[model samples]
Structure formats: structure tokens, C-alpha cells
Target: MQKRLANFDLDLALNVTESTLGILGGSGAGKSMLLRCLAGMESPSKGQIVLNGRVLFDAKSGINVPSRDRRIGFLVQNYALFPHMTVAKNIAFGLPKALSARQVRQRVEAQLAAVQLQGYGDRYPIQLSGGQQQRVALARALASEPELLLLDEPFSALDTHLRSQMEQEMVTRLRTFNGVSLFVTHNLEEAYRVCQDLLVLEQGHAVAYGAKYDIFERPGLLGVAQLTGCKNISAAAEIAAQTVLAGDWGLPLQVVDSIPDRLAYVGIRAHQIRFTEHANQCNTVPCWLVSTSETPHRMTVFLKFNTQPDHPQDYHVQAEVFKEKWEMLKQKPLPWFVQLDPLRLMLLEA
Candidate 1:
């Protein structure tokens, strides 16, 4: 069974158990919706969500179990701490009271220690900094000892340096949980750095879901291509039928790949465009220098083109090179031959 999301269009129906799948997408891509659906925070209009051999939600089968029994620990965005409660109380909230006072105190103490907040137990949420408070949230979630963990934008609140630090800590701690961990984040770099597998979403659909390397190198679909930052995309026929790229540059490119005559998008990374010494013999073209910005370690050169037969806005190609390249050809505006690898030019279906 399946139903449409409020704003995004997706047909999310799958059984996730024991595998930690990282969902990376921009906001409102239904990543959190699916998680909430699974957790029973938001009921699905249709479809079924199963976790660890338990039937959580089923439309036609009519078997539904609420979130509590599903054994899912969710760390939502914004930490969601109890402002008035002490840190220890927040973590202890998840444990059963049937345990003696000694046992409860022992568990909370252990959790606080794990999150590096050993003695911050008596302090309320306001007394703790944002990072420390988030630690409390994470500690509380893990305190439940759930079989599945769902973290949504878990590190967005922290500063860059703190975020990196927490990620290392979380990965090491989560390793021993022995349960499925589904995490969602809009940060591509975070997804790359933290997740073992990636599920790239676009407009509420699973455009690409697989190993992280494959999605970055080849998105396997048009939506995924756009999301993965393929700037120089063009139809496949434009390559075979024509000898150049878009816009007016008319920069002649040799057709190396026997591409099928179909609507497709071809892309090359900005850094991939660079200069070569052999201007006469290389696959170079007559290009004029638009502008240059020199940084301590590198230089970015913008090339103004007369024509790029099929590109948008008469755009200038942005290329980055080492400071040495600028020094080697100092004080001279020169036309360099461009040698673009055919294999580097990815062709994805439009």
C-alpha cells in the first residue's frame, strides 16, 4: 500500500531492519516523513512499515503497532530537551521506574558519563550549552535501549568544529548498538563522512540509493544528477549530432563515447577544467580570460567565451588551479588548450 506525501511525491514502502541507511536530501524531501511514519508519530495514509520482523503498520493487513512497542529511539531535530528538568532526569525519563532508586541513578550516571557530561546531571537544560544539551538528547534516546535509532539532522545545531567532534563520538558509540540506525541530513559532506551507505532523495522520491561512491560518481538518474552538482549537463544527442557544448562558445569537443541518440545530460566538474601547456596539439580552444581571484593556496580563473552552443546564460567556465600554475605563466594573459577526458564527461538520461 502507498500514498502521496503532503508536498513531495514519493512511494516509500520498504522493510528496514538491522541496516543503518543514511538519508540525505534537502529540506522537505520526505526523509523525516518516512522516519516519522515508521515511528508512528505521523500515520501514513497508506503503506506499511515493518521493523525487525515486527509488523508496525500495514494498510490492507490492518495490523498496526504504536511507536512505543516498536522499540525505536528517535532523536529529532532541535534536541527537544526538557527545559526545566535536570540532565539526569531527562535521561532517566526513558527508564522504567520499577527499577530501584539505586538502579535508576546508576543508569543515568552511566549515560551522562558516556556523553561526556559526567557531573552535569543536576543542571537544567538552560544551564547547559547547546552542544551539551544535544548530548543529553542523544543520551536520552540511547537510554531507552531501542532496537532501532532514528536521528534527524542530529548535528545541524552545533558549530562546524563541534559537529565534527560529536560525529566521531557518535559513530564509535553507535557501533555497539547492534540495531538499524536510519539518519537524515541535508549536509552532503556529513553524509559522505559519516554514513556507510547513502539514500539520495529528490522531490520526495528515491532517486538513488546505494553505496556513497556510486551515487557521487554516477547518480543513475536525472534528478540525482542535478542534486549531485553536475553543472555542465547537456543532452546526449547534443554530443553526437554536434561537435560542441551549449552556449555560444562553439568550443569544439570530439565525440569519444558512442552515446545513444537520446535526451540526456552530460556534466563535468568545475575543478576538472584546467589548463595545459600544449595549446596547439591538445583538445584546446581559443578562450579569453574573464577574471581571476588569487588565494593563498590556489587561483580561480574564469574564462569568458564567445559561444558555448548549448549552455545557459552565456555562462563563464570556472576553473581552479594551483598557485604554481599561475606563477609559471605569470604576467601574461594566455590561451591554454583544454584536454577533457571523455570518461570524465558523465552522461545521464534526461
Candidate 2:
């Protein structure tokens, strides 16, 4: 699917199988726009969107399905519920118009029970809690037995505690839904917890899309690395088949396999840094302690390379450790040797 806007450009080409797939990107990166295109709420410049072997959108064919007839459940941010309608009426609204009054009531009851809101069906949206209102919205979406589900930051507006609860509830609720579900979220932890596959978008392009584990383990691009929470990235040049000189870290990193021929950058997660006393270890370097910050459960330690202080552009590397490790390290010294694991290192392209 592709769309061109005044400020953003979207170019995505991929197939989504039956599973919960995550669309991860920063704000205005075309996450919601793509969802709208899929829902037939927004037309793409030119592309085809097929669902369950049905052609939903084909520019060349001039076939565009209406949003109401697409049989897709779109759960947007803020729940998108009708404030004036009771929970039962809200859910019943999704029922097909052809259904009889008795059938609509039966279906609404079933949806309420499915979402564990049997007794709250008479309450209005204003009377319900944030989590309950979200459930009502979800129930309405699911009431029609949609062939596909599109969630656009469905839990983003909830409080931190409620958001976590809703995330778990959604996962459980969607387990029985045997269709494709696209979950758009910028929070990596939310995506990691709720999605089976990942689609990483950058500047409206599909930078990386694959199984969740594969995308996390081997993010091939620099943008993907940054999106995956890799705080330490350095310029690099391939010195040999299995080694590359990391210019920012001031070390030559050796990997288990041969490095890419045109490797342009290297990335390591902050938590991947290992403290060691031996300076002779492979890929170990002594760094001057810059500063440290303490959180409730972990510590963020900042360090700079032992290189001369003349290079102000050289950024400090952030290393994270649990409080227990911080306790042991704090008792010892200021200068420490940090080892970069060969297996954990990521060689990336620009």
C-alpha cells in the first residue's frame, strides 16, 4: 500500500498472514494513515488491498469497498464509543441491519458476555471507567464478526496502570479471533508483548518487517536499530571479513560470522554491556566514567571512551545494569572495562 501526503510519503508492500502484527513507528510516520487506507476510510494514491481473498481496494480495477461493508473492526484511540448510547446499544449498532430485533438483542448480549460486561450493558459510556469503555468499543467492533481487526493506539489514552491491564485483556480477548489483526503502537514494550510479527516503518517506508524475534535480533538498518531501543550506535568500516573497526567506540569488533561487505554502522543495546576487570578480553576497552543515574530497579551509567577529550563530537555510551550489579560496581572503582559481546553486536547499514 502507498500514499503521498503533503508532509509524508508512504510506500509499503508486504503480505500479512493470520496473526497479530505490529506496526511500530514514531508519530506522523503514517501508522494511522495506513490503517485508514486499509479500512477504506482513506484512499491510497494507487494500490491493492485484499482481505480474505476479497479485493478491498484496487486502483486499477476501480474497486473500493465501503468502510461499513469491509467487515473490518477499527478500534481507534479514545475508544471511539458513542457517548450518548448505552453499552448495549453501542454493541448492537455493529449488528447487521438485516438482523431481526430479537437477533440483534441476542447478539448484543453475547458480545457483552464475551467482554465480561454482562451487567454493565445498561450503563452509558460516561458512567464506565476507561478500561470498561474500551471494552465496550472492542465489543462493538467484534460484534459484527469482522474478518480483520485494526487497532490504532487503542490503549494509548489510558493511565499507565490501566493501560497495562488493558493490554493483557486485549491479548486474551483477541486470542479467539482467528483473523488478521494490525496493532499500531510506538511503544516497543507494548508491541513486544502483544504482537507475534512486527512491521517497522520509518518516514512512511517499510524499513523492516518480519517475525518479531528476527526483526529484534537482526535489525538490518540504522533506523530500525534506533527504533528497537539500541542506544549505542557507532560508525564502522569493515576491516576484514569477520571484523569491523567501530569508530565511535574506538574498538575493532570481531563477530561470529563474516561482517557485511558494506557495513556502515554498529549497534549494541545498553543492557548488553558487560563489566569486566580484565582489559585483555576480546572487544574490551577501558572507558572513563562520565556520570550515573539511579532508578528504583536499575541504574543508567554513562561512560566515554579513553580517547582524547579534544573530540567533543564523540558521544558517550550509556550502559544499564540492575541495582544488584550497580551495588557491586559502585564499591569498586571509577574507571572500568566494558566488554561488547560478539554475539550481541549488530552490524547495520545506513
Candidate 3:
């Protein structure tokens, strides 16, 4: 499908079966636009959308299904719920009008129970907590038994604790859902934990798409490496069949596989940098600490090789170590030996 927005143009073709595909990207990368097109909120400039052998949209044939008739359930970023209606009414709002009142009531009750909000149907959305409000929104989306589910940053508005809790609930719910689900999020960890497959977007174009692990372990593009949380990347030029000069780091790296002909950059995850006692180790570099920063359970140690002059902004690599390891390493002297494992190195293109 292709969509041309004010400053962005999205051009990509995707095929999804009975699986949850996570859309990952930075701001303005068109993650939400893709969801909007699929949900019939926005029309694509061209191409066809066929779901379950039914044509949802076809530009060539001049066919476009209205949003209400698409059988798609969308959970927006804010969990858009009716302020005046009770939870039960919100869930029943999307039910088919042809159904009897008794049927509607039964479906509403079933959905309430499904989302674990059984007896709270009488309460308004404003009366519920953020997590509870999200549950109410989810119940409303599922009440009509949609064939396709699209979630646009559903957990973005929650607190850290609440986001974690809702993510677990969402994982459980998606497991039993019998339709294709498309989840949009800028959080890498959230995407990795919830979805089996991943589609990475950059500037409204798809840079990578495959199983989550495959994309994480071998992100083939510079933008993809950054999006996947690779902290260390350097301009590279092939020096030999299995070696490349990491220009920004002032180091030549040995890779496990033959260097790709189109290599533009090389990367390694922060946690993959190994500390070794011996300077004789292959791909080992003797380095001095530049500085350090800490999270709750992890510490980021910035370092530069002895080959480079001391400068505050010239720290070449940052290694993330567990707090326990950081405590031990801090007791050691200068000139720490770190190894860049060839197997863990990522060769990337522009």
C-alpha cells in the first residue's frame, strides 16, 4: 500500500496471517499511519487490502470499505471512551443494531467478564483508574468480535508500573485472539515482549521486517540498528575478507563472517562488550574509563582506547554492565581490557 501525507509518504507491502506484527519506529516514521490505513480511517493512494479473502480496499477497482463495515477493532493511544456513558454502554455501543436488547445485554456482560470488569459496568470511564480505563476500552473494542485488531501505542499514556502491568494483560489477551493484530509502538522492549514478528519503519519506509529475534540479532541497516537499541555504531570500510576498520572508534574489527560488499557501518550492543583480564585476547582493546552513568540495575561505562586522545566528547564506546559487575570492576585499576566478540558484531548498510 502507498499513502502520501503532508510531509511523509508511506510505501510498503505487507502480508500477515494469524500472528501479531509489531510496528516499530521513531517519531513521524508512519507507524500510526499504517494502522490508520488498515482500519479505514485513512485511504491509501494505491494498492489493495485483502483480509480473510475479502477485499477491504482496492484503488484500481474503486472499492473502499467504510470504517464501520470493516470489522476492525482499533484501540487508540488515549483509549477514547465516552465520558458520559457507563462502561456497559460503551461496550454495547458498537454491537450490531439488529440484535435484540437481551442479546446486547448478554454480549456486554460477556465482554465485561472477559476483560475482568464484570461488576464495574455501572461506573463511568472517569471513575476508573488509568489501567481500568484501558481495560474498559479493550472490552469495548472486543465486544463486536472484530476480525482485525489495531493498537496504536496503547500503553503510552500509562505510568511505568501501569504500563508493565497492562503489557502483560495485553500479551495474554492477544494469545487467545483469533485474528490478525497490528501493534504500533516506539518502545523497543515493549515491542520485543509482546509481538512475535517485527516491522521496522524509517521515514515512512520499511527498512526491515521479520521475526523479532532475527531483526534484533542482525539488523541490516544503520537506522534499524539504532532503533533496535544498538548503542555503538561506527563508519566502516572493509579492510580484508573478515575485517573492517571502525573509523569512528579508530579500531579494526574482526568479524565472524565475510564482510558484506555494501557495508556502511558496524555495530555492537552495549551489553555484548565483554571485559577480559588479558590484553592478548583476540579483538581486545586496552581502554581508559571516560565516565559512567547508572540506571536502577545497570551502569553505562563510557570508555576510549589509549590510541585516541582524551576528550570529553570522544568516548568511543559505551558498555552496559550489571550493577554487581560494575561494583567489582570499579575496584580494578586503569587500562581495562574489553573484547568485541566477532559473533556479536553487526554489519550494517546505510
- Listed per model in order, the count of residue pairs whose N, CA or C atoms clash below 3 Å is 15, 0, 0
Query: Can you write out model 3's per-residue Cα lDDT over 1-350, one digit (the tens) per residue?
Result: 99998888899998998889999999899999899999999999999999998899999999999988888999999999999999999998888888899999999999888788879999999999999999988888888899999999999999999999999999999999999999999898999999999999988899999999999999988999999999999999999879999999889989986677799999999999999998887789998888889899999999997654367776999999999999999999988899999999999998
Judged by lDDT, which candidate is best? 3
Q: How close is candidate 1 to the true structure, as a TM-score?
A: 0.84
lDDT of 2: 0.88
- Tens digits of per-residue lDDT, candidate 2, 108-135, equal 8998898889998889999999999999
Relative to the true structure, how large is the alpha-carbon lDDT of every model? 0.72, 0.88, 0.92
After superposition, which runs of candidate 3 have C-alpha atoms over 4 Å from their true positions? 307-309
Which has the greatest TM-score? 3
Error of 2 at 314 (Å): 7.5
By descending TM-score, how would the candidates be arranged? 3, 2, 1
Q: Which ten residues in a row have the lowest lDDT in candidate 3?
A: 305-314
